[model samples]
Target: MRDRKIYILLTDTGTVLTRMIRLYTKKNYNHASLSLDSNLEEVYSFGRKRPRNPFIGGFVKEDITNGLLHNAECVIYSCTISQKQYEEIQAFLNEIESHEHSYRYNLLGLFAFMLKKEIRRKNAYFCSEFVATALTKGEIVQLRKPPSFVAPHDFEEVGDFQLEYRGKLASFYHNKNHSYQLSLSS
Candidate 1:
């Protein structure tokens, strides 16, 4: 059977909230998302439900073509997983999406992480925490620490992920399409 790939997207959107997070973490990317496809057509994250309002947040199916990710800087990493693991991930995400209203962004958990504490809220999660939990639930990666403690940078350090791309989030699609066109013409 062929192995399937999942993507980890680390982004720095340079929003006011992201700027505040940068002050604390001093990291290049302050947000993370998981994508089921290399084209990033199926991306998920715990972030603002509305681009203009950062207050209302939950599990979101991200649209990279607009909003915060439109011009964001990002790094994409791909991890190979068995078909069984891929199916597990799909089922997990589907379950969450089906009851999306029950989930909320873990604001308190984020603060707990800053305080070096683990707060696993029943159905809430911050971006990286959610991504880590998803991968763990899929049986693809084992976490040395609690999912609540996982950060965007930590995925790079822990997983056997391959660096897929680095540059603007918008440009990823542009470049991918450009490269495909180049190959097609050759």
Candidate 2:
């Protein structure tokens, strides 16, 4: 039997949350694929001009919902939405649910949904282009460099060691002999 797939629609704001979910869940899922009409940047730009109107935001949510419904067996929305905004989404979903041909829908609030059990229940889908283009180039560059460790000149006699950072404290110790320990505390 084929495993059921759960589609997750993620906003840029919820990228971190999504990554955490994927890491903890170890399930495969698809991310919402957006076209011009459903692009988040366009929605935010348009919403900025009509700050008092909820229609644009509602429409954006609906677009995401519709996009996920196209292929997913179930859907999970992972975005940082305020209570008021969440209420708006729930109302909108209810309206959509009343339609004759709407897919089964589920709303998983970003923070609340991060729980391990909840995350493990579904697979995650991510947009390759979005991830590749959205990630800061600098962060990628940083990742390529070998991590460095430094100690006072007095400890130069000690061989190389692994470095660790702990809030305001930087330390290095030899794991083999446990004969060397160097620490700098701010």
Candidate 3:
């Protein structure tokens, strides 16, 4: 019997990577086993101990890609690394891709797509139009209107801020001298 081939999807964000892995396992690997690791702890420790430099960080990402490529059939990278680090991973993959013993693998970045307005609004702030459209149509609508210019540090207006996505709805609250208000909801 042929040995069951395993595909590994690697990423810094364990949650998203695990979700992808679960989806893949359900679709392709009913009998095959899977594993998930965040590697965030190690990354945090290394970042704290090592000098803050791109070359060292690039080497770390390269090492991870190289090690995983040795045994896995394919690798899906889903990290928020810079382009230089990404290039280093690609270079390592190119070196391994030539080997006949190796399985086909790919390195992917999580933030490959530009931050579209819809995703930004969904994640950053709650817009009524977004909520109504998403609720009514069951689909996302891109913010077609041009965004007004606002200073990055406009705390009073809350131009845009990052918020965690808990589920279908996201909420953000701001507190002032005398009153508190919810600014964003989706």
Best by TM-score: 1
What is the C-alpha lDDT profile of model 1 across 1-186, one tens digit per residue?
Answer: 789989999999999988988898888998999998878877899999998888899999999888789799988888989999999999999999999999999999999999998888999999999999999999989898989999888877864887878878787767666653111110
Tell me, what's the RMSD of every candidate?
3.2, 22.3, 20.8
Model 3 — which ten-residue stretch has the worst lDDT? 165-174
lDDT of each: 0.88, 0.24, 0.22
Candidate 1 vs candidate 2, TM-score winner? 1
Q: What would the per-residue lDDT of candidate 3 be over residues 1-186, giving only the tens digit for each residue?
A: 221111122222223333454454333211111112222111100110122321221112122222222222222222233344334434433443344233211111112111222222211211122122221232111333322111111111221212211111111111212252322322
Q: Which ten residues in a row have the lowest lDDT in candidate 2?
A: 145-154
Off by over 4 Å in 2: 1-15, 30-59, 62-110, 116-186
Candidate 1 deviant stretches above 4 angstroms: 179-186
Q: What's each prediction's TM-score?
A: 0.94, 0.19, 0.18
lDDT of 1 at 21: 84
TM-score, predicted candidate 1 vs. hidden true structure: 0.94
User: Residues 110-173, candidate 2, lDDT per residue (tens digit)?
Assistant: 2233332222112111132222111112121112211111101111122221121112111111
